[model samples]
Target: MIRRPDSLKTFLQAGALAGLCALALLQAPKQAIAGPSGVAGTALFQQFPLLYQGVLVEGMGGAFTAVADDSNAPFYNPAGLDNIQSSSFQILNISADISYPSLYPTLYNGVSGAGNNNQNYINAFSSVAGQSLYARVGDYSNYTTHDFAIGLLSNNQMLGVANASPTTTNLGSLAALSDSGVVISGAYGFFNHHLQVGGTLMGLYQMFENIPSLSKTQASALSSTLSDNLSYGFGLVGNLGAIYHFDLPLNPTLGASILNVGTANFGNAGSLPQLINAGVGIDPDIGFGRLLADIDYVDVTNYLYYTGDSLWLHTRFGVQYQFPEILTVSAGLYEGYPTFGVGIDLWAVEVNASYYTEEASPVPGLNPDHIVSLQVAFGWM
Candidate 1:
């Protein structure tokens, strides 16, 4: 019998998710001293956008910096690897199973760009109502992310919930996560055919576990687990890229890049600020495989937050195909306009099983949701 207004509506939904993670540590943009709005302004522990989209020309549709090379042109533009005569290292991976109020399953891991599947098929058919249970969720919901980049990156991202039921329980370790971070990059290439440029240095470490249970076999009426206050800092990310190719008669390839404008400090509650991205890529010479496209622009809103308000300004598109050339086909679209995924490519390995829906209100998000992804890469030239 857990009363007291249901424990004050579960700490007001965990203090409105800790005031959106204390306003992302006071709208972090480096330059310090921020975090206040009760529980720091809570947004569920902040740091949510960016699950490995560090350039690969945004995986297909978002295109590739002029058909990216010398292995990802130093995070998409170390001046396009300044015509790297030769010298390379590559290994990339992306995994996912994202479905919100839409398809009904949720496990958002790292994203590799290119999405929009008819608004996830009309939010998975408008999350069924008749008998309920379509993508039904509640116990801590879902969100997962991981990135293990070698000499160029060593990823980390986590959202919440691995357990939750009639009375709530998640004893620990689905992979015990609350928040994680790390990204260190450096690149330089010049002339001949590759003109690349690079810069990246970001660090993050987080752990927030506030468990409060009072039923489900009332162990002590209200279980315990509380953690917070362990933020971090350090930012000066940079990337300016270029790639141009025209061997003619379809030997066509074009690329352009701009990423992470600056700022990143998570130390004394402040900074995740500064972000700018620009893209374009074309790889033509048609045949059985290889076709790409991309476009991106993010100001994070208010042109740069003063108190921000409803802004996810998004525009995404993706296309992939390895065809009889070895089987690999994809599709895309994003933001409330959904229409998202599908994948599989053996050669260098890429997998994203299936996805497609257009919401007819049987149950999903009322209709748009279906996503899957798996990626592994290696090639040194």
Candidate 2:
């Protein structure tokens, strides 16, 4: 078992300093963030632009606030790191993801035939209007022992969608985002370890590109230098979280967190919105396996600027069953859409996969983006 440091005072001081510095680094703009530049017609509301999302968490419908016992704790609720009994290190964690792959072939053929004709381009884009196409690649590695943890993470995401309005000058829209960062976290327990509080400092280098109106002429002259339009910046952010363990049946826990404390301004790349999230969870050993259930309310501050969004869009529910060192299965609801995930562990190597749907419109179910994600990792536990 990992041993606590000689003095809790030192740890607490370090944690507090990290949090304050992150928040002091940026000033939140008074005006609300503007919508994607130049896009015509309705666009999706963006909420909680997290730096990283793990497959296991996504599979569990993203309701991990109260059940953050793994490496992901630093991102969800660092206080959960207090539950770590043994030191763990992940040497490598690699992932790849795709959204709506079923529609790829049709889109590829349509784009290939459009050529330089404006009407053909419109027709091709209209066929897939309101549909989302996306792909991503990412990696994360971390080490944790008891009340302290550190990690590195990076991701690249590309997304495209046709203009929702046919009368607009745009044929389609495209966006690309990249984030690379380091995370330093610390936690402390109180009241005989029943209550834990923690904080994290995240330093990030971010780049973004948003072409909300890709006209026919632009599409015809697309070249490798298209990334010249990207805007890049660097920033630091902070998170504070706490978890209270209740002496009740099923080992109930309550968790809450304030993320992106003062919001982070990434220059022309845009800003990260502040969010308040909370959750309740229970973990019970049921003879044959362990059962976990969690319910969460995310983005409690309602950073979403769009109308038509319901409470269901911010509600998340999930359940997972684990069989010792062998396999794990999970299911849940995210943004009112069903999600499923599976994982296999074999001492030194682990593999996980998940299927989930994300909403791309102000209304749930109106524009669904189905995603398939997989991860492989090598680690010591």
Candidate 3:
């Protein structure tokens, strides 16, 4: 059983926090209008951070802009598909299980004590608690030749929370987020494979859902809301990427990508922002293993949202060591937060795990949120 705050002051503080959340939502940037949020304005946009490709990239703190050599290249930098030597198919699942230690207690307190006077508190807690689960799944298939490569990809992300304890609370909410799409990408290599250029044509889909109002009565009769509150939108987008490999020491690589170039209007939800990514990577053989290091910069154009700071430039750094096909370890910093990941490869299947932190709110004083991801990938070479 979770302990509840006893003093009125603590209760007031919780309410104030909820109020701030609502105010923040009202003042949120244009891009956040269609995103998920709590009744009191706690934005759930951070629940779906910039999408990364696979467990390998997440393990490296999302520093794959220049190191995109595998099936994930279409998502990270399509130009990297030029490096693929064989036909391949791969699928990945990435999930972020976020837990708010302080927020959950307040929520439990608000819902456990149900009275007419506390109805507003109960609604607020339910709204905030309903965004606890964030997950994504994707698949990539590529066919490569000496000078050309083509691939098909699909990816989806979902954010929602559920409490289905029949004996306790039956409240639940779901926010099916934007940015799931199917992409057809192709890459062409030139100058003896020293340079590669690629492009992706994406078919986009956006979705959203919610329970209008949550109360003890509604919680008990929530089965209907769960089945009916779904909304969707469709659009298209384009991406272009390029990579140049230099035969210098350690085989250094330089890459750049312009993502989401076209408009994806989710009706009233606004347009998806365009992003530019650039990075450099080095792969050096060190006898026992291969050491890989990368430095990347992600710049968002036409959006000022999340990350209390006004800087549009996000920095990422990652390093990984691979002991042939058996084991790999990675670590890095993603927007100033520490991230660690490990991978085990056994010929046909690979397993990966990562730990990282993300900002739950862009407000200056709030604590950061954490995520744990486990992935299993199947590959056919």
Candidate 4:
């Protein structure tokens, strides 16, 4: 058991700070946050973008075998770090995801007797298009997320990934976006007890461009205006997990982690933030991390809670094969898109790529969308 230090006051302060960080994380360009960005609207609506979706899951095809290779392992499965044999190192993870959301307003509207001119239908399209700008009020812009991450894991903490952009809410000050970053994650494990727990600390900043509101005549012009600033708040995400090594010839291992159990900020929204992700793997013999095949349930992005009555939940299935001399494969499904990808490690470089095809098009009359994606990963171990 981890002992509690004397002051309850100190604990509260740290908790408060973490909550604020959570809030800052959800803040970003409005409509630009749909799908994986989280739903837009209300405090809860904006809270979705803060979800991590477990990035490393991509390489392993959603399989977390070593658990320690990812710095964010604690956020996904706390028990992951328990398997780590190394002391400290810096790791960089960068993935670019592109998504084109389709609109079936005509079908829904026609069936519901709400014509194309229906206020409800228009609002839906306008909502998705104007989301991030709507909340911020003036930055009327939309683009898929271009993500970048840099991390360092040492002794007990994982650091990097600054989420300073105002995504869910309209902070109005661009600089506040810089203040919110996540880092310094720590873990505690009773390896013998088979129980391990980990936690993360977050910093928050918020700001936005005055995009303009419905009531303003010159709201369009406001998009050109920009502002920035900082605020202090806190919240936290945690992992509670255990690994059981069965007494068998193959010695299969069972493991589970309840992630985001620790609550963090939700911008001004109340928090009930918790994520539970689990995985299991068996090893013939453990060498360096290993060449194994595993599959898992993982989130590609957060589902934003739009209006009090509307919510979007986004998640996917990840299947992967590892430790093979040939190419490794990964397949996934999200929203209405089906994706297949591949990876290969040669010499000292890793090359990866994926393509997507939509279940149906959004043009109301045309065929569903057909899209493709390409990506590559490189590193030196």
Top candidate on TM-score is 2
**Better by TM-score, candidate 3 or 1:** 3
What ranking emerges by lDDT with the best candidate at the front?
Answer: 2, 3, 4, 1
Worst 10 residues of 4 by lDDT: 134-143
TM-scores, each model vs. reference: 0.28, 0.86, 0.69, 0.48
| lDDT over C-alpha atoms for residue 222 of model 4 | 28
* Clash pairs (backbone) in predicted model 2: none
Q: Model 3 TM-score?
A: 0.69
Model 4 TM-score, 2 decimals? 0.48
Task: Please give, for residues 38-65, the per-residue lDDT of candidate 4 as tens digits.
Answer: 1122232232223332333543334452
Q: Could you tell me how far off, in angstroms, the CA of residue 228 lies in candidate 2 after the best superposition?
A: 3.4
Task: Name the weakest run of 10 consecutive residues (lDDT summed) in model 3.
Answer: 34-43
User: Which of candidates 2 and 3 is the stronger one according to TM-score?
Assistant: 2
Off by over 4 Å in 1: 1-99, 102-158, 161-189, 192-197, 203-248, 252-381
Count of backbone collisions within predicted model 4: 53
- The residue-by-residue lDDT of candidate 2 on 80-177, one tens digit each, is 88877778777898887788665567767877887767777777778777788777888888888899999898888777776776423687777777
